[model samples]
Target: MFTRMNGIVCLTMALLLGCVASIATADEALDKAFEALKTYKWGQDRATLGAIDAAVVASHKDDAAKKDLEAKLVAVLKSDAPQAAKDFVCRKLSLIGSAASVPALAALLPDEKLSHMGRYALERMPCDEAVAAMRDGMGKVKGLVKVGVINSLGVRRDAASTAALVGLLEDSDPQIAGAAAAALGAIGSPDAAKALGAYQAKAPKELKLAAADAYLACAERLLADGKANEAKMIYMTLAKPDQPKHVRLAATRGLLAAAGQK
Candidate 1:
């Protein structure tokens, strides 16, 4: 998934790209940007893409501008581009993708070489359809691919996956179980917190630390959202001496924070 830092870099690059595109014709600008996506070169082709990226974002609010860019992107996906070339487009889509891009992005989910980046785009695409696509994908893939899907859903904070994630807490693969635990924490809902709490004794010893961390995260979110009492329950549980010293400290601090809520 793109981090805040990546978003910052993309925005900065887009601004510079905006300046570059102003000097080029419409056809010249897009062709140059498409070429840059294939180069995957930094400091060099990034300038071309930066201009293209800026154009996409600036046009998002205007239906015609958005559709034009979206069409160009779809054309790139439909082309027989190399995996590297396609991957480059996926990164751009993550920044400005909508439901229109879902089918193209969704196609990459089952591909071993591309599933990671595929999820990367789908995770950031702000639409109910994007969420549904990933959620549906969870059952169709397995092992690490499924793990990737789980992680993306977590990053998305898809509360709808709470039950599915809770079910995954029982998987024999420790990593899968651990990922599920961490994802539940990312969700940080009252029910998610309860599930994490319930999974405590059943989760492997290797999984407890993640559970603890997630517990704290869920509690903190609940506290912040005016659900202090619910948050306090988690805080009290983790504040127990049996929890690791650091977790106990965090729980204590959370308790104090919760006390100040309305």
Candidate 2:
């Protein structure tokens, strides 16, 4: 059984992949769509939402228009536009473009254009190549780059990266550790839960919070598998106020949720 996040992540990739097809051309429609993107601030404005949607839909039917739009999007990604525009392009790639744009998007990751947004774009890529790139690049990078890989793997639900994620839970950098713990929580696997639990005693506040979330999630699955005692202890720890506020809050809610479960 997939978790809610896992289902949404898979559905996102599937939907993006499914949307890849040739677009037809019509000057009025293409112009309207581009205007929508510009006016809506790249889909952030509710008023221009319809126009943005129209543009994306129109692009699917116009090959020349689609290529032109993708080029524009990439340029938007590269341009000195407001941070909001760059962010919107990076975050909405899957929503408006095909997998073919993935290579171009991936190329942006190293451009020093916007490090954080580049990571966001890479995470949104609709292909396994993105995961491979993150994994292969992990050892060569540190700090935010490593954090990006942790996030991308979680969003992808790439279980194969679980061991690497677990290893990062103890990384010298607390942010990296925290990201690893959060990724594990998002992955929500029993193995990840156990890995998090094993480090709970020494993890920092943020890492502890993340570990607690993962532990509670994992405990739920374990409880579902008849590991009652094990699950109870994790819930018990989480419910204690002595824990970090986030951890305590998560644990208390987890306990309540677990109690009502059959």
Q: Which candidate number has the best TM-score?
A: 1
lDDT of 2 by residue, 210-237 (tens): 6776677667766677666666667887
What would the per-residue lDDT of candidate 1 be over residues 1-262, giving only the tens digit for each residue? 9999999999999988997786566658767777766545434545667656777778866988777777778667767776776777788788878899888888888888889988878998889999899988887877888888989998999899999999999999887788888889899898999998898767778888888988888887788778999999999999999889999999999999898787
- Those runs of model 1 whose alpha carbons end farther than 4 Å from true positions after fitting are 1-24, 28-60
Residue 24 local lDDT, model 2 = 31
In candidate 1, which residue pairs clash? 17-50, 17-51
Residue pairs of candidate 2 with colliding backbone atoms:
23-60, 23-61, 23-62, 23-63, 24-61, 24-62
